[model samples]
Target: MLPSDCPISPLPRSAMLYCEIYAEVKPGLFSSEAKSQSSDRTMDLGLAEDHFSRPVDSFVASDIEQLKQAIEECKRLILELPEHSEKQKDTVVKLIHLRLKLQELKDPEEDEPNLRILLEHRFSKEKSKSVKQTCDKCSAIIWGLIQTWYTCTGCYYRCHSKCMNLITKPCVRSKVSHQSEYELNICPETGLDKQDYRCAECRTPVSLRGVPSEARQCDYTGQYYCSSCHWNDTGIIPARVIHNWEFEPRKVCRSSMRYLTLMISRPVLKLREINPLLFNFVEELVEIRKLRQDILLMKPYFITCKEAMEARLLLQLQDRQHFVENDDMYSLQDLIDISSGRLSCSLTEIHTTFAKHIKLDCERCQAKGFVCELCKEGDVLFPFDSHTSVCHDCSAVFHRDCYYDNSTTCPRCTRMTERKQDLPDEQDVGS
Candidate 1:
C-alpha cells in the first residue's frame, strides 16, 4: 500500500500523465508555470506512472497478423518433424522450444513486468530497421516475419523482443550493461530456467518450486544441482578459513565438478574471458613450471608459500623447498594495472604454491559423500534408502553401516579411541 497521504482512488477520466501525477505525489504542493519546485524540502520520490513508463497501446492489425503467422509456422514445423530423418532432431527440439515460448506469450497470469523491462533494454539502443534482418542469436528471421524487433547499430545483430536474452558474449554492438539481469535467466550453454530447473551436474530435471525443498542454487549463475551431487554440510577446514575466502553463486567449472566447491579464489578467471595477465601467468605455471592440472585447478588465493603452510592448508602439498617464506599474496589486479603502464611493482614476487587448506568441516564447500573413509570405497557408499552419516568433528562422510562397523567413531577423526587409556606421558604432552 502507498503511504497514508497518497490516495488509492482511481485515475480521473480526463487525467493525463504528468498533470494528474503531480497531485498524487504531493497533495499540498502546487506547480508554478516555471515548472520549478517552490519548496527545497521536496521529498525524493517518483510518480506511480511517469512519462518514461507509459502504458503499452493495444496491438495494431499488422502486429496481430505476424503473431498468427509465427504460430502457424511453428505448428507446421511440428507436423513436419516426424517426416524428416533423425538427423533433423534439432527441428523437433526447436518445435518444443517454440511451443513453450508461445505458451509463455499467451499466459497473462505470468507476472513478469520486471522481465519485460529487462528484455526491452537490449532494444533501447537500436536504430531504424528499414530492411529485413535475421536474429543474431537463434539465426531466425526477424524483420519480414516479426517486424517489431531490434538490431544493434554497430554489429547489426538483429533479435526479437522476447529473444533479447539469447545473447551471451560481450555486445560487439555496444559496451553497455543490460537493464535487468533477471531477464537473461537462460544459461547460454545450458538452456534451463526456473520453469525448467535442471541439474548442472546430473543433466536431469531439478525442482525450484513445488517440492519438499529446492536444490542448492548457484549464487551467480542460478543453476540448480541435485542433492546427491552437492550436499550442504561437507565442511573440511577451519570455519575461519572458509569465511576468509570469497565465493559467488556461480558454478566455476565448465562442467560438473565432481568433488569441488563454488568457493573460488578472487580474480577467478572465466575461461572464456581470460584476462591477458592471468592468461600469461597460467601459461607460466602450466608450461614453464610444469604444474599438474589438479594443482592449477585448485587456484589457491594465497600469495606466498609460507602463508599457506602456516595456515595448515597444505593438506596436499607436493613440495616445500620451491617457495620463499615471507611474501604477500600474489596480486593479479596489480599485475594487470602494471601492464597498462601504471608503474606497479616492477619485480613482483610470483609465488608458486600448491595446497588444500579447507577443513573437512570448512564452511565453503558442502558435505559430499565421496570415498568412504572407513570402507575406502567411493561416491558416498550409502545403504539403500538412507542418507550418509557424516562425523561432526572430523567431517568424514560414511554410511551408517560403516559408522556402526567402526564402533561409532569416524575413521578420520584423529582422536584417541574411547577405550584407549590416557598414559602419564600422553597427559604431559596434552598439558
Candidate 2:
C-alpha cells in the first residue's frame, strides 16, 4: 500500500483501486516493505502493458518471464482474497487473461517437433446437427461459421486452428506401423468390455447401453470407436480384397480408413500364397496368372536379345516390373484393377508386345525356342504356345498331342537317366 503523503499521479487508476482494496481486505497481506515492492510491481505492470502492445515476434525471454511473474502475482493476490468475492473473481479473470497472453507470446513451432503425419487438413464446411464435432485437442465444440477449423483428409482428426499446434497425438494412419500384416479377420471385434468401455482412439468413455454415445465398430481394425473417432467413412479393406476378392467399400473407423488408404498401393499381399482357390474362381485372376507366367518366360529372352534390349522391351511393364519379377504377390490396387478388368487389359497389351518380340521380331529370342522333342518335329515351339506342353521336371517343351500320346513322360528325362546309368557302368569297367 502507498503512503498517504506519497504522490500517486503516475500509477493507473485501476492499479491504485486494487492496492486500496487489497490493503483494506487483508491488512497483513503486505509487509512494511510493501510500498517499494508495490512500486516495483507497478513498474513491471507498466512495462508488461507496453510489451503487450508490441508484436509477438518482438517478445523476448525477459518479457515472457515478466509475464509469468505477473500471472503468479495475480494468483497469489486471488488466494489472499475471500472466496466468491468480486475481488477474487476479478483477479481470477485477470490471471486467465495473463495466461492467454503468455500463450500467445510463446512460439508453438519452437516447442514442437515436426509432425510426422502428413495431415491434409481441409476447412470443415458441413456441420452435423445431430452430433456436435469437438476439437480433438481442446474438446471445445467447433462452431462451423464462427470458428474456422480443420479436419484431416485421411484420419478425419478435427481441431480448431488454435488447437492444432498443441496436438501431440500421432494420427491413426501413423499407428499402422505397429501392424506387420493386414487384419485378415472380418470385423474382429473384441467386445467393449475388452476396450474398458472406452474409445480406441481418444479413450473417451463409451457405452452401448447408453443412448447418446453409441460405440461404432471399424470393419477394418475390428476395434470400437466413439462417434467422433469413427465418422462412418468407407474404404476398401485389403484383407477383404485378398481373402474374399471383395472390392466393395465398407464402413471403417478414421484410423482404419487412413491405414487402408496408405496400404492400397503397397504390393505386400501374396494372393496365390494366401488363397490359391481365388485363381480357380476369379477368371481375371486366372488370366493375370497366365500373363505373369508368360512375362516370366519372356523375361529370359528379353534379357538375352540385343534387338529387344535396344528397343527397351522390358520398359513395356512400366511400374509393373514386379509382374515379371514375381507372379503371386499383388497389391490391393492390383486387385481393384483386376476387378475392373483394367489390370488384365494392361497385362494383355504388355504380353502381346513381349510375345511379338520373342516370336517373330528377334532371331536371338527365336533361337531360344524349343523344338518338339516328342514329335521330333523341325518346327520350333515356344513354351507360351497354347498347343505345347512343358515338362514338369526338365522344362522341355513338346507338342501337346504328342506328349499325351507318349504317356506324358519326358523324353529328355529318359535320355538323362540312361546317360547316368551308362556313366556308372563305364566307371566300373575302367576300375
- Local distance difference test, per candidate? 0.37, 0.70
**The best candidate in terms of TM-score:** 2
**What is the per-residue lDDT of model 1 for residues 1-431, given as tens digits with 9 covering 90 to 100?**
11232222242211222223333333222223222322222221111212222137733454434444554553343333332233123333333333333333443222323223232233443334455565655555554322345554333445666566655433332322222111122233433474366666555566756253356654324366655444443321211122222222334222123112222122222222222233454333223222322234233423333445465444433222111221222222322333343322222212132222322333232132246777777553311113456576754557667776786556566554442555666888999
Q: Highest lDDT, which number?
A: 2
Worst 10 residues of 2 by lDDT: 35-44
True lDDT of residue 237, candidate 2: 82
Cα-lDDT of candidate 2:
0.70
The CA lDDT at 113 in model 2 is 34
Each prediction's Cα RMSD? 26.7, 13.4
The digit string of per-residue lDDT tens for model 2 on 302-339 reads 78888888899898777776787988878788889999
